[model samples]
Target: MPDTRHASISVDQFIPAPPAKVWDALTKPELLARWWAPGDVSAVVGHRFHLQMPGWGSVPCEVLEAEPYERLVYTFNTTWTLTWRLVVEGKGTRLLLEHSGFDLDDKRDRAAFERMGKGWQGTVLPRLAEVAAAEG
Candidate 1:
């Protein structure tokens, strides 16, 4: 009748840089690749791309929403959705990430949810903060 599954990961981080710098680090391929996976990503809605995650293979992604220096949303591997929101705080930016749409009942998804949750919290977002703050 209806879907009743809910499993997501949220990563909120503060970067000591302007939204433009943080946005660039999120949208620009060079800067994005430096922290996250490498992809032909653009800050254009509806643009489909692939993020190459070395050992994990290439994952298809599509830009669902893009608001420069404010917000971004995309689909990861068809099912998962990654939504990023940036809020300007003084001269810095408050970065928010929501990685959703996990079918926790499925073993694979559960494993990935746990693994990626760790990855995003432990490595990905911290690196993004560094890369964004370092952007000049």
Candidate 2:
């Protein structure tokens, strides 16, 4: 039996750019394709989009909150609530990512959540830094 506890993933990263630049990489579909998944994403609340997840195919998403250059929250694949909070710090921006609402009771879901956590920390964040830096 898998652990029946709820789980969440959080990551913190500092990019060598302003909040607006980071926000652009996050909100703009073109920049997002460079770093994250390719999708028709917008900075508008309630906007629905799907990202091409390589082997996983298209993952459905919906924008829940869009607060300019400060914060953006969205639903990821109808399972997790992904939140991005940007804060200007000194000469760069601090990016706080929270991917929550994992059902750890199911083994498959738990494994997927763990893999996603690693993917976010390793691939996603680094690509985002590169894109944000290039945009800056």
TM-score per prediction, in order, is 0.93, 0.93
What candidate 1 gets wrong by more than 4 Å, as runs, is: 1-4
TM-score of 2: 0.93
lDDT of 2 at 49: 94
lDDT, candidate 2, 1-136, per-residue tens: 7555878899999999999999999999999999988999999999999989887799999999999989999998878889999999999999999998899887877988879888999889989999999987
After TM-score superposition, the amount by which residue 127's alpha carbon in candidate 2 deviates from its true location, in angstroms, is 0.8
Q: Give residue 37's lDDT in candidate 2 (0 to 100).
A: 86
Give per-model CA RMSD: 1.6, 2.6
* Clashing pairs for predicted structure model 2, backbone only: none
The window of 10 residues in a row where model 1 has the poorest summed lDDT is 1-10
What does the lDDT come to for candidate 2? 0.91
Model 2, C-alpha of 70: deviation from truth (Å): 0.5
1-136 in candidate 1: lDDT tens per residue? 6676658999998989999999999899999899998999998989999999877699999999999999999999978999999999888999999999999888878888889888998899999999988885
Q: Residue 16's C-alpha lDDT in candidate 2?
A: 93
Clashing pairs in 1: none
**What TM value does model 1 have?**
0.93
